[model samples]
Target: MSIILFIILLLFLIGQQVFFEVFQILCYTDFRLIRNEESEMAFDGIVVANLAYELKEKLINGRISKIAQPETDELLLTVKSASGQYRLLISADASLPLLYLTDTNKPSPMTAPNFCMLLRKHISGGRIVDIYQPGLERIIHFKIEHLDELGDLCRKELIIEIMGKHSNIIFCSEDGKIIDSIKHVSAQMSSVREVLPGRDYFVPDTMSKADPLTVSFEEFSSHLTRKPMPVSKAIYTSFTGISPVTAEEICSLAEMDSSIAAKEYSEDLLLHLYTQFSIYLSAVKEHTFTPVIYFNGSEPKEFAALPLSHFSNYMPKEFSSISQVLETYYATRNQLTRIRQKSADLRHVVQTALERNRKKYDLQLRQLKDTESRDKYKVYGELINTYGYNVAPGEKKLEALNYYTNEIVSIPLDPVRTPQENAQRYFAKYNKQKRTFEALTVLCKETAEEISYLESVQTALDIALTENDLAEIKEELTNSGYIRRRYTKKKVKIKNKPLHYISSDGFHIYVGKNNLQNDQLTFHFAVGNDWWFHAKQAPGSHVIVRTNGAELPDTTFEEAARLAAYYSSMRGSDKVEIDYVEKKQVKKPGGGKPGFVVYYTNYSMVIDSNISQIRLCAD
Candidate 1:
């Protein structure tokens, strides 16, 4: 009886293996599974499936060691698994719902938030028993097992739904009773569902979308034909796991336009689209995910858990793990988002100053134009002095031969004043106008300089990636008198440093984040023999390449020039003219503004600001 049982267990295991092998073969054999051509970064249902699969592989059976809520909508969980320790970040932010594994740490508030404290109390030391997705939905379930107060094993379910503004993270008991959620949705907040404690946990089926993983071809064709909307809309609206990108991809694979109405497609085309859709679904079922990030030049355009053929015109960077793709994509995106949020006040200040200075500059230019007649007054005075002796007493007008132009001219005079006094009066007016022109010229230059300085500060704010970088920018603004400095007991030292990059030829290149860093980089950190580059006549970063007494390669010069263009006000331009010179040739003018430099002789090159090939180094 024991031998027969062993043979049966072996047969069952073999059967399971064969079934998976057959399924994988069927997934790869379909010729209709053409690559989809779509570009998007939204964490759709299919993306969630890929993430869930990765998490299950890396985090299952892992022990939860630490839990933190760095933001109101974010949670960071540190887990130790057989492979290694990993930090899993989950956020249900309305604007950017995200879930990924990361190694970086975020600073939390001094006092733990209420929801964070509650999670710590309940499942802080639990083990992740399973990670799964239900019915190809845009939700992940983390099944955690822990000891109760009675020392009995208790299971809990943590569900995370990525549904745009409706995204949420809910903690529930085994019986599907909602214990708490990161975001509480009352009836007033959402008419479709109410998310409160003691409420039964359920996903609202408002869309009535069919499950894509199990939907038959007949159902797909029927549902699509019923919709009078565009083909892309019909595909996403009729299927549970299909996003607009996925729908568009299906249409592209069928060689049909997504904008056309679904009713316009022939029966054969609809059948082809359904077959292609099934092929993609089969890949998801077999877990054959290819995590890729598409880039438009140096900027990340979009990311996906599967290959995006629509982004073929752009560069595709593949990653071994989906977590890595998410981490890279969101890290850059979040940095830009945070910088924009923090720099709003600074940007307003700079823009205000820029507008004021521009107005002043324009008024000064107009006033200077009014002084164009100053020379005419001087010419009148010269004629009066040359021919004043012949004027009769109480002469209201004098006619004389103007020697300068050799033409007769008329000069109006006060009848009560002598000829000499009238000449002196004209001379006085000439002197006054001359002084006004001189003063306005200087003021115009100053106003123009102020405008340029403010624009440069705006460019600096655009390139800043961290809070420390922002602090340095704030300090620069305070020093420039754009922002008022508050009274403090101690001086705030700036810890922001320049962006460091290594050229392909091993040359070290440094880019300044702001004016102060520009000054520091071009003056103190650089030697006389080093090379300097900046965008010609544009507000941009000062890029310095350390020569170390060696002749720099042409590639290094091109790379530095690219950096200068990318970090400047002309970033979006197709090509920017960059001026490069030796550090010794660059000079700071006397009483000039910060980052203002004069270089009489320099080599220039026009280059595109695509620095994707450049490698950044740690400072």
Candidate 2:
């Protein structure tokens, strides 16, 4: 069981490592996923502008027919599209940018969540005509035309401020009367617009360098070299919207080290670098080979494609345009948010169980000490066997055997007494230390299996495109005792699946695992004349063979013995002792663990657990 847990932990760590590697790759590519869209926009504006171009065309004039807040930091808008009905999700939230489609809508309370209500009041039914961002400034604006309550056609602007530490969406009328913001700011917070009622609104100032999309090789080199920084740092710091992730990506595409100092480049090197930069810009503009980045963990620390906090660690100190960073931030933040939220409960459960199990294991260790001491009982018995009644009674001393000059001996004892008595005494001492070790072992095995099963279930749950698939897992869990049954039901007799197999000579055989199964397999399913098999000195499954008037074969008897071994805890062991007899001789103990049976006059044999070579029949 401990071995199984170690395997599980190793697998989980390996999975996390793989996930982070993939995340890093995805982060470096032109993929829109950055750690935080809001901060990215504030830091890398131009990137957001370019991204808006891709979305504006598809969404312009689209009716805001549906709205949903899938998460605290996300919004999904359903619009009628020429291709089909399309869902546009805008994640301006600092933490996660999330947008997706759903055939079924989520339930909205009488009052909506704050973000949801803000969106509905400001943008609902509005025609999204255009989306734009200032050159690399970490801000985005959506221009919409919608009818007022008075039925007048009016233009409203929803300004999404992606500025670092000041990200918000402010809604305003054409005259710039503040409607409401997703997040309210006060004069106490910043000199920027407070986003309060009747507050005047205007675009924030750009605080960074010149644009990348329009710069020439000489100007680009001149501007970059002036920074006296690494090429990656120069590009990221000089641009408003270029995150370090993008800067590094650009350098990678240019086939150069991003960390190389810009001042170290010669004129020819600068020209070649500038030319490649242009090519990369053009490729990005054309949407060629959009990359996917993945984050993976190393042995000591987990690596994220974008820093887990995209703006703080992963973003460059300076950027061309804040808008660009905003776009990447939203994309990356959304991905991380989803992964973290979905896996949160499962990880918590596993970690809590592991801690509890560790404590229980300590108790088990202390309890086993007394058992270790009593193993010396075998040594005492051996001494008695060799020296007989000649030795002093109750002597704990290890006396030398044979002559003193040549040999001294304390013989190894192999006891053949009833193991139950030794085991009971050992357990009594173990129980004194902790009564819960037995329960802990059971829970540990069960928890390990459950965690593995749930990991598989989560993958299935994610892909459940239809209600039926979702219901199956829910039903399976409830039925398997993970959840309480909610529905009322009439009590029905439960029928266990029979472990029927065909012997080498064609006789029908059945093996039972528990007491209930044993009763059904022996008394209800098998004939009285059928043969039975079980372990000789240890508790195990009840196995029965139906002869049907045919003479028994020795080969069949051997196959039955193998089945008994396969079902026992010693299942992979080389050999196990099994007792066989006619079904007539076996009787259930009046009060014992299910499968406990007393039998007279049985044949014994040692057998291995390779019984699959013998044919099996469910019927």
Candidate 3:
């Protein structure tokens, strides 16, 4: 029986396409999914609730010392308390709303926005007397105490609602009258509520879902059974603030198949589920947060405030605080999703330019091929000049000895013209063809180079992990005339830098992430003795190794080559050919594009595009 079970499991793994390291290998005794689908590292009620409790513990009486509106939908606040000064970031971006305590700061506009000015006026020096979440809904309410214009103590409410595209940050009076909001929703936009000034503040009804926190046993089972969907879907949809992943987790803890319909659940199954749900509900009431991030190999899969035993097949990494988990998960996810959204326009421009150049390059190559017969015209001219004098008048053909090939040749005669005129005509045709071939030779080379440069820009977009990287690529395109520059009063300073890696042998290797950075590293940062590595005949970053006048070990050389291969357009190949030479040997041509260089000689090696073994610099 054990051997038969092992065979079934092996077959399932092959069909799933997931690696053995992930949870796809995990199966129940009856072969049902413990969790049907893996969700994105989520920001749900559990995250918000855990965060509220953490804030309640840490920021009970913290005074708001400084406030700045960084993005239009975001705020950075500095709070000082008996504990220490901390920075909190709250963003209501429709696509990705988040609230977290951060250590970094963003640049604000020279002129404060209207909503920012209003917040400063009302709550600039307010003390956070209480921080709480009403239920499991994605909302946090801050009861702030401050002095009014007449120096009388007053109470105000600052609420942040993280409801995806409906997210908003609203300031309200003590009686729940809306004072102002960052994003206004009028009757025309949403029929549910109006969020303008003087309007009452209230959370939109969530399809009349029950609040899991205060629900009785009878309410839990009756509400869940009334739904006509899968048990997981019914659970989250029937309750406030609970997410689908959490619902599935509750079912897994109950040892029940979440794929089963809630309407089909028996009385005994309902009791088992309620027992599990109450256990987690009790944990929330007690404020027991065991935050952890689950990883599928090197990539983060999901995170939760409580331990998720259903994802036991995945690698769980526990963190000390929910703040740490939020920071780590979102930063990594932001690199994958947010940065792509931010750089979409830049990517579109690069893609359009690449398509145009590629078409032009293909057409030029075909035109260049038609000029191959130019040499044949030259041969015809020579043959006519050698033997046409002996041809009779109005003759059609002349058979003569061709000295070029040491063989007999037949030359056709235009009967209307003399032999000499025919030869001259052939010479003229040869000259025109020669001129076209010469012009096309140069044009093809230039067109090919333009295509290569555009491809390199495309690769840079894929490598970009932050806004700064996109800015550098955008600047390069503007200078190259691919994109028109947008006028802005403020000249935003770009602080883009190259990726630094430490070689296994302790040598420092720097890889440029974009064309401008590549130019800067190759021309200004690297010394004559430093070494440069690039993918041979490919569009790639310039990898510079700071040798410090010492000989590099073999390990360092291979690692540098791997960096070059990984950042290039040919990163998909099992092995990439790399060219490495001293920085002094690499030279930029006059009037060349950014990152375009010429090297006379170099050493070559074939290396794979794997740098997982390399250590990135802390900075």
Q: What is the C-alpha lDDT of each candidate?
A: 0.86, 0.58, 0.85
TM-score of each: 0.74, 0.46, 0.59
State the lDDT of candidate 1 residue by residue for 470-560, as single tens digits.
9998988888887898999998777778999899999999999899999999999999999999999999999999999999988999989
The residue-by-residue lDDT of candidate 3 on 97-173, one tens digit each, is 77888788889999999999988998898999999998888899999999989999999999999877677899999
lDDT, residue 124, model 2: 82
Worst 10 residues of 3 by lDDT: 28-37
Q: lDDT tens string, model 2, 1-619?
A: 9978975776587787765665554453323334434233233443454455655656677778777766554556687755456665555555433222333345445656776776676568888888777654667677888777788888888776665445566778788888876666666444655667578887655445767778877788877888877998898777556777667766776667777888887888777778766776674455432322222100011111122222221112222322333334444554544544554554454356456656665565565544454434444444444554343433433354543234565533224433333334444544543444455556655554444444434433332223333344455445545556776677433433546678768877787634455666776777767888876655456788889867789999998888787665555677899888888887876643334467768788998866645665534
The full ranking of all candidates by lDDT, starting with the best, is 1, 3, 2
User: Candidate 3 has which clashing residue pairs, if any?
Assistant: none
Worst 10 residues of 2 by lDDT: 296-305
Please identify model 3 stretches exceeding 4 Å from their true place: 1-42, 61-80, 84-98, 102-129, 143-157, 171-183, 196-202, 205-364, 378-413, 450-498, 513-532, 545-562, 570-613
- Residue 23's lDDT within candidate 1 is 51
CA lDDT for candidate 2: 0.58
Give residue 251's lDDT in candidate 3 (0 to 100).
91
Global lDDT of model 1: 0.86
If ranked by TM-score, best first, what sequence of candidates would result? 1, 3, 2
